[model samples]
Target: MLVSFSPSLLFTRYNSNYSTMESNFQGIVPASDAPTKRKRPTEAEHIPTAPKEPPAPEFLCQDCVKLDLSKAFSVEDTSNETTKMAFAPGRWGYFNAWAVDVGHRYRGTIITNCNLCQMLFNSRVDEGDTKLDGDGDWLRAVSFLEICGLVAYKPHRWISKDIPFLMLFSNKNYDLYENRKKVRHLIQQSGYAALQQLNQQQAIPFSPKVLSPVFDLGTFQNWFDYCNGNHKLLCRSSKSDLYGTHVIDCQDQSITQHEPGMPYVALSYVWGQPQAQKAVNDGKRLPAQLSLLIRDAIAVTQAMGFRYLWVDRYCIDQDTPTAKHEQIRQMDAIYSNAELTIIAAAGQDENYGLPGVGKNRPKTRMEAHIGDVAVVWAPKDPQAAIKSSKWSTRGWTFQEALLSRRRLVFTEQQAYFECNAMNVYESFDIPLDSLHIKDRSKSYEYLRRGVFGGNREAEFGRLNLEKQGPTEVFNRYLSNVEEYSARKLSFAEDSLNAFRGIAQQFWYGKHAIHNIWGMGYQTPPEERTSSFVHSLSWRHTSNCWDLSQSPQRRPQFPSWSWAGWEGEVQYEIIDSKQKSWFDNLIRAVSVENQIDSPTALEMIAPNPDATCIFPVVIFTAAVVPSKLISFNPNAASNKRWQIGKYKANLALSSGSVSESQFAEDIHDSHVWQCVCIGAALKVSFVMILKVDDGSDLWERAGIFAIDCYSHSLEKMMETREYKSFRVR
Candidate 1:
């Protein structure tokens, strides 16, 4: 349970609910050791009635609060949003530290890198040799001044309780004085830590702030009521502790019913998000999942003898508050009751295929025509010729790679059913002092104990780690496939380089005028300053010496735009003629943030009332069979697309095609930049794709295609997955 402290009690007191929590909010001023008066930025003497700041977060550690100084660096933070510029490496690097009155101590940090942080924390923890409940929660308290940056790991003890008071930062730099002052001022305010903690637990971390109306999760008259609160249970007095794990015995109105199903098994799919998400083919593949990921959840459950499975979408109403809370709170039970949590581990190929995480693989249509592929001929006889057709399948996708590997662990409550499913392992058995397959005689003893329930451990033993190590198999298969891909990429890169050379020369040939087609070129101020017409004798040289638009057209170099380069500004390019001749004509058009490019096909997590619109342009003029994209929306939006199983892609020409839609389904662990070239293309973004309104259009992202110039590959990453993936 979480307890809030009051500012009036001073930094030393740890109490609940300070009455003066909101009294006279003060600016965060640094704690001064010297008595001489100094003007701190937070002093009321500087800015009197500044707008009230959000509640200050308290440091979340017992060591910090008790001034132990030893146990520090207890911060829990969420990964950076992919839409944010900070998430470049496709992962989040959290910095956790412990702040105190004396010196700063960083307890630990968790990330792909920064192993030192974890190593340090673990070392400190091991030195004490104190055992903790494996969940990592040991009640600890911290104050505002005692902490800095986002808490890397909130004390597990506070879940469902008041959020452990916390402090977070926008960037890596932490200004001690400013941070200390902010902490001091908030500590002086009553209930700042408490209320903020209270608010944090009731909401999703890092999500937008929205006050949803409370909902009533009541029973309906239907056979489906089997899973909901029974009439007798619902009739129980509100004081009754009716709902425990999965049963919703109505405690009545005091506790708002969030969803119709108060307690039910949630058999939703969990997408396996590897820490590194590495595969053998990823050029520099780091760490990878070596397992069999179940791509079909429904199929897996039915395979386990369960007839009806209750998934969140089919069992609850997401749009309602009652539904959300009931489900969110019931998450613990839903999974516990679930027969199994099937993870999608389908690969791009049945056996050997690299994942589809990088840029889209664009192949020209003509490159696929392999003539050696022959079909049996039909004979004009009584017997019809055997149906003769030869077809080739496209290469695998990253999304399929994503779908192919996952881990499923049964909670204590669901452990009993391990054997009920098709899994190859089991746990909670008897000791194995002399247990070995070689000791065939031990099998009878183990079986005796397992059946008699005499010594579950000594008999059944823990889950056999050795049974069916398929993930290793997956990795091995990937190794062979990656080698093939590497060779293919080498060939493709050569072709691409050749095409690029041709394209550049044809578009900007040696004799090509510099300014006529600089529409997409963004010249810096230094270049523009020189080009600016300042000679006062006449007019703007660019306007006066503009070349006729007719001369700009080329027989071979056609632009993607149908709009002629009219209404565009002309720049002066000094040629052999002493008098400057304006040849470089450019347009000043706004560039879309590139939010809806292929990178966002369906890999987005959004707040309610938010929709991510991705505008993708498939180059119909270019190659390969057909392009397929995977649209895996984040968990909030459970969307599905039906393209049937496309064995082969249709020959595409630039005809109108509907933008396929899939709601966000699983949570995505990585974020990358979406780059687009054209500044002339108009774009709109929304948090959700709906009929009349947009959830939110985020224009804050400062993304651009020009940044790619700094990147080595100078290419944007893009890929798609089919909607047929049964896993949500």
Candidate 2:
């Protein structure tokens, strides 16, 4: 005989033992058993009854209902303790243990016996059922419970691979899941189709058309043919002007003469540590020893149907200084004119070959799953990876990447195809329309025009600079320096040499702007004196301006130029909003080039030894009286320099200038000369200085500024006589 178990029977059994158990199992009291008597409250003893809560929503489950109570677990104590524990550890611990056991048993039962749970575990829902409230809600609840570790389910292992098991487990609503699934499915299918197109050498229709992932040789060939046939700008080069002395013949698998205009793929990579690789000589055969990177590049070039490949290690003779210098000068054109550039951005050194180019290339995906959805974690933006790569951080590689017209970047995540018109990746597929392509093309065209001249109208129009003035051109050069300064170079002496290509491009036809040292090149010859002085007003963006902190590695360059520093530099003179008042006050008296020593002009060939030529500029300027003021708020006495009726503050630290001598000057002499003017509005004046040794040569001592403009100072400036001085 089996005993029946019912809520009424259970309540009846526990009703006699505990008064709180008088209610039904649902925590609801029967209407007949509820209190009927009414209690009256006296005027002196007012009683406040507890507020009643509304019934739980019908949509909630039985477990949800139990957990939804405001105070589900509570204890009433009749002891002397003032603070009563709401929940006892021993009592709740037992209930928790029982609940865990019951949940485990239920999970086992669902896994082994529940047909509905098993059927839906790895199955894709139909379109109609996907939107149905009952089906979606139930499936989502089960998935959420599993993800939260409240339930044990292995849908990914036992179900279909295409099923998106994680979608059901996601906390997002049905509409979001649907939209995300559609996009993900499209990307997945496009990736598959791209791989198939490469392997089979067959074209397949892909949706949303912009995806261009090059996984194999066949796909790369297809893209190459399409670009060559369609893009008018991507014209083939004649075999005469290429700069490399040697290039690897992809077809013959041997080194050959580098012919100009020959269609060859160039490799951009990091050299890493010095490797004992064979260099090309005056021979027709390939080197016996080759770096892994060069070998991989050769293979890729051949596979992509190119007959020749240019790599720095084999192409340029590093042992010969003359050959290296000449090649370095032509680096910009070499990369810019390449048929295609292969960037090994993911690799740290030459030993690390391009992924997917060699037999031992590492695979990007892992065999993992979340539910039935085959999870693939790939970089969403390959350009970002390329930018952050070790290759990009190197000084030479920056110009290489910027100059290249088209590039096939091999990143750690995936391959990306980029040209002036568009950038496409394997993981994401977006079609390239003419308008979008044109937008991208215009940007590159602008950069090219700025570096390599094309139509000047578009370039000047974009920058909104006056066509006659070189201010925008100067700013553009500084922008290049700003980026180049942050990059790393192995040899400090190669600083100017590495930047020579870009410098040549910037100063292409401008005869007035001479590439003196590095700073004076941007200034016109007529204004060389004033411009050179203005250019000296550069400040370190990262650290305080200190001459001692400047790197002495390249002492051939002067401390006044940014080329002397090993870190980033920014010019304060380029602030366009500021009205320059010092340009007219200072005049260039004479400019001379000093070679070897500080006091000589000699004709020398363009040799490495002769490259360290410094310009000595002489200027005539009106000197004004100024003083350094202590602006430190914590100082004992609030002292400031009185300029006429207005008080002025020091712009730079006194320590950066004269140290203890600055303090002595402040105590001994109340006068200081104003060397140059700075940003307008605040009307900053750079303090003038005579060397501590009492030499006629002058330098910038410090900076001082007044809060407001004073017409009285302009009258005082007219009364002052101009003095001549030599600047080194």
Candidate 3:
């Protein structure tokens, strides 16, 4: 049954809808009474003012939504609760009143969250409130209203398609790893009232110089057309410019249709699964359950009368950060002044009633809230649930769920949002546009590669190396790699070619889609049949945005063997266990190791024996310090140098740096050498290494490799490490 939630500090109430019409039903216009349906002469459709449908709705069948999470704010006085409640209506209403509501239905339930600001005007009626008279008054009202925007640290994929865990501020402003800390701190403790001083308190700036609006929402008769192609105020735009700006730039220029695609709907993509196919479908409870949990929590606080929900996406506009940051910085006052700070997380021990398992793992934000709600999901049928549990057996599944829920929110003496090691930088909100992750066009964005800059399709040369003659394909890839001046690929061109070659040959080697790994389109929930069905969608805001999945995006000077390679460097299992961690895996050594020779490199490499290629991935030192420095972590700190680049061809250099390990091992100082052996291929590279460790900052260095691999491993033969692992 559909349930309407109450207004609470965590869940915003919507009894008073700002939209003109509650629903859209098509019928003949009365002309006398308020016209509910307008059959405009085609000319009126082109008029400055026209009625349109509201934003896409939320899923109706969702039985559960995640529990509401509170802003990480700190308040010292319990007496402040009443005063906080006072600021609830005016402040919250003033900002959200401009938003238009859209009802999202999944299964049988309707989600009450509004879609976007545009939907507000789209819900026009023929009456005095919001009739479409070709006038200019309403546009003026909206234009004059101070507009605010927010730019977050998340990639467009995370913020626009999936469950975007919001950031309190930009990663550019602070360190990125700070998120892990804040999350940990809140889980272990709950004295959260001392974090109020560190919020972003800057206000949005506005300009009044430009004008020429459109129809008014309240009167519907007034019209204001400000721009005649000359002056520029954001609101004033031609239809072409408006449409051009519609998609809202999902960040990858290569994939933009340059036109608006689908709009956001809370649970729309999930419930459509069963209907899409048959018994092969699986539903996602993450988003739906999270929403319901949040709604229920809002109810407890709303019973006491408070309303203001601040989610990052719809609530805070992203394009305008100054204004959004100010509101976010005051999250302490905003949340503390109002009613409640609902934590969406559940405690593993409490919710699942499995205390033993939870006691062992470290506490986390999600684990602390288990006592808040009890949940259980019914598969479409007993058999379907059985099939689904093939991977995560029911008993283990319960433990996994329990393991995920843990949290605590502590506070500093200062009364502001907690911005510290423990809190992590989560903004306590989800992004407005996170649901679009399923769209193929937006998800596998790197595939398109933006070769010509328009929303261009990716040009994948058929990598049927066997058909094209492996030599021909390999030579073509080499020719292109050698042509580039940069040692590594700054773009996706080289990588894309490599993977397409692998996809044509080896994807079927393991003979399974699950193991083959797409640079797949943004994976859609309704389409996921198993836990392993993952899309190469961006996972987090941890970096700027990774678009290197497709073959068209490969690195420069990359081996065709490295074509399907992903991440900082390409790796292959020359010999690996079916399920052992130590199976022999061959990795193309990145420039990080400064591996002048393959044998010494093997001692200190993520994947041993892959030659040091100049185009190897340049990883952040924090993530892979050994790769950053030539010395191993076990080496003395004084002996360690942070230098990353290695000479591309060590054999050619007459006075290359001395090998310290060999020097220590030898009795004679006469330039002793180490390790002689099998045939190995070595490719030298001089390259620019760069990475986005969330700061958008780039660092580069010179480097090279001499890699060694045995014929057995090259044949994908099992090594001691490879043979020991098994999937089960």
Best by lDDT: 2
TM-score comparison, 1 vs 2, better candidate: 2
Predicted candidate 2 versus true structure: per-residue lDDT over 84-182, tens digit per residue: 534331221211111111121112212222212222233222344443333222222111111211112323322211111222221123343334444
Candidate 2: worst 10 consecutive residues by lDDT?
93-102
lDDT string, candidate 3, 1-728, tens digits: 01122222212223333111111111111121332342322211222332232212221112112322222111122335665532221121221212211222111222232221222122121122343233221210011111111111234332211111111111112222333344223222321111111122422111111000110111110001111121122111112211111111111111121222222101000111111211111121112122222333223223223222222232333456564444433322222222113222223211221111111111111111112221111001111121222212111121111111111111111001110001111112212112112421111222211111011111222212223332233222222222111123323543332223222222222222211122221112222211111111111111112233212222333321223333332211111112211111222222332344322222332211132232322221111122233444355633333223322122111112344542232222122211111121232121222332354323221122323233332332222221110000
The number of the candidate with the highest TM-score is: 2
Tell me, what's the RMSD of every candidate? 33.0, 24.9, 26.9
Candidate-wise lDDT, in order: 0.21, 0.45, 0.21
Question: Order of candidates by TM-score, top first?
Answer: 2, 3, 1
Off by over 4 Å in 2: 1-244, 277-279, 284-287, 359-380, 434-471, 509-514, 520-535, 544-553, 572-585, 595-612, 621-626, 629-674, 677-725
TM-score of each: 0.17, 0.55, 0.18
Worst 10 residues of 1 by lDDT: 382-391
What lDDT does model 2 reach?
0.45
CA lDDT, candidate 3, residue 207: 11
Return the lDDT, model 2, position 673.
43
Per-residue lDDT of 339 in model 1? 27
- Tens digits of lDDT, candidate 1, 383-483: 00000100001111111111111113221111111111111111111122212233321222222111100111122232221221322221212222221
